[model samples]
Target: MTVRIVVDRDKCQGYGQCVFEADDLFGLDESDTCVAAAEVGEDRRADAERAADVCPMQAITVE
Candidate 1:
């Protein structure tokens, strides 16, 4: 199944932790906001989950 990722921009601090944890699904933009690095796939679900886990702001949700 295709994964859905939601990042709460207001709660995010742009720390980039999610980017490192899930490079295939997360990134930091020029504005330092979190961005989707790529469309999420089943194989990348774990990475997405890890990103959610490590997000200090608790701003990421995956479904």
Candidate 2:
């Protein structure tokens, strides 16, 4: 199984909090915007959920 990660670019503020929770799943781009992987193994669901939880803008969604 795999979980899907979605980040709302308009709602994102370039904060790297998600990166701290899961570097392999999230990152900052050259423009300082939040970038994230589209999907991850079910084993990483916790990491993805953490990233979403810490998002100040609530820009991240995991499903």
Candidate 3:
């Protein structure tokens, strides 16, 4: 199954915790806002989940 990483832009505060956890999948934009890859493979499932868990605002979801 294809893994997807979802971030709630309205709820995210751009804390960078997700970026620190999964640099390959998450990042800070020019405005320092949270940005994430649209999709990931199974191999990155754990990392995606970890990123979601580390989001202080609970704005990230991996599925």
Cα deviation of 21, candidate 2, in Å: 0.7
Q: At residue 31, give the lDDT of candidate 2.
A: 86
Candidate 1: global Cα-lDDT? 0.85
For residues 1-63, write the lDDT of model 2, one tens digit per residue: 889999998899998999999999999989888999998899999999999999999999999
Q: What are the TM-scores, per candidate, against the unseen true structure?
A: 0.87, 0.95, 0.93
- Residue 34 of model 2 has an lDDT of 90
Per candidate, the number of residue pairs that clash is: 0, 0, 0
Worst 10 residues of 2 by lDDT: 31-40
* lDDT minimum window of 10 residues, candidate 3: 27-36
Q: Per-residue lDDT of 3-56 in model 3, one digit per residue for the tens?
A: 988888888898999999989899988877888998889899999999899899
lDDT of 3 at 13: 91
lDDT of each: 0.85, 0.93, 0.90
Better of 1 and 2 by TM-score: 2
Flag regions of model 1 displaced more than 4 Å.
37-39
lDDT of 3: 0.90
Q: Return the clash pairs for model 1, or none.
A: none
